[model samples]
Target: MIRKTDLFSGVIILLGIAFYYWILGSYFPGKKIVLSALIILNGIGLMVHIKYFDSYKKGTYVTFMGYLATLGFVLITTALELLEIFK
Candidate 1:
């Protein structure tokens, strides 16, 4: 019994791995974008897994909060950079 959200997470992970070998292995022009995307998407998958299902076990608090804080920082900095304020 797989939920849609869990299926989506699995798809993201599979695509990430495939893209890693295919996009990063050869002379792809958008390698930088692919690399960054793989990193972010994998993290997003983990975040989704954390949020969508299951009870919070012990040791995952720091990891969860750190991922959230990092995401927030990335969003804020990206916004500022887009506005030409955080150069």
Candidate 2:
């Protein structure tokens, strides 16, 4: 039987991809706020997965690392935009 945590992780991965596409495919009004909230949500979801599942599998690590990289890029871009706004 498949575990619920496994399903949840899969959903989170899908969400990250969907979020990426969503950002890419449209001109989001208030992009900063939306992306910032998404980043926070992803962080919280990761923490919850770690707390509950407690697995150190290699695949899981790689997947989460990829997600982090994507988030990091978004964060840097967002920061630059904020700087431009303030300047």
Candidate 3:
């Protein structure tokens, strides 16, 4: 069962991705700030989900894998931004 917070966070993440895609050809400071905030929120949501699983002692492996995947996503996204790959 996904919590409301998690669902909201997922929506934020999707919106952020869309915003980033939309702004790929145009550079704007405010858009960058919004993207960063959304990424951070997604990360926080991932952590919350992991913590919830840990507390319940269920699907620990899956949660750990999810954390790894989330970390990878963040790292890759940051690297691409730093490298200006989208620009």
Candidate 4:
């Protein structure tokens, strides 16, 4: 039961990350890259649960929220990195 909406949401989440990086065009050195990647994993997790679970009641909302919250963190971290705030 892989609904198109769920799949599209996953795609949009990835697109958001792509746009974020494209707009900044900055490379993360070491550990910082993990922060960016977590969002991708989160989005994939969201999609997987929705598609595979037979009756996942709250998986969709919870995973999507997690992705969004982490995306915010990624944006903040990227901005701080660009600003050379703590380096």
Writing each residue's lDDT as its tens digit, candidate 1 over 1-87 gives: 655654665566466446545653366466556556655665666676567434323337864564455445444433332333212
TM-score of each: 0.49, 0.47, 0.46, 0.32
lDDT for position 14 in model 2: 65
Q: Ten residues in a row with the worst lDDT in model 4?
A: 78-87
Better TM-score candidate (2, 4) = 2
Order of quality (lDDT): 3, 2, 4, 1
Whole-model lDDT, candidate 4? 0.52
Put down candidate 3 lDDT per residue, 1-87, tens digits, no spaces: 976644654565565467558755567668667555655665666576556655434556775575456555645555554445334
What are the Cα lDDT values of the candidates?
0.52, 0.56, 0.57, 0.52
Number of the predicted model whose TM-score against the real structure is largest: 1
Model 4 C-alpha lDDT per residue in residues 1-87, reported as the tens digit of each score: 766555655565575566456534555564345544544554565565456444444467885675465446445544544443234
Off by over 4 Å in 3: 55-87
Clashes of 4: 0
- For every model shown, the clashing-pair count is 0, 0, 0, 0
lDDT of 2 at 84: 35
Error of 4 at 20 (Å): 20
Instruction: Mark the regions of model 4 whose C-alpha exceeds 4 Å error after superposition.
Output: 1-59, 85-87
After TM-score superposition, what is the CA distance of residue 79 in candidate 3 from its true location, in Å? Answer: 5.1
RMSD of every candidate to native, in Å, equals: 8.6, 5.7, 4.5, 10.4
Query: How does model 2 score by TM-score?
Result: 0.47
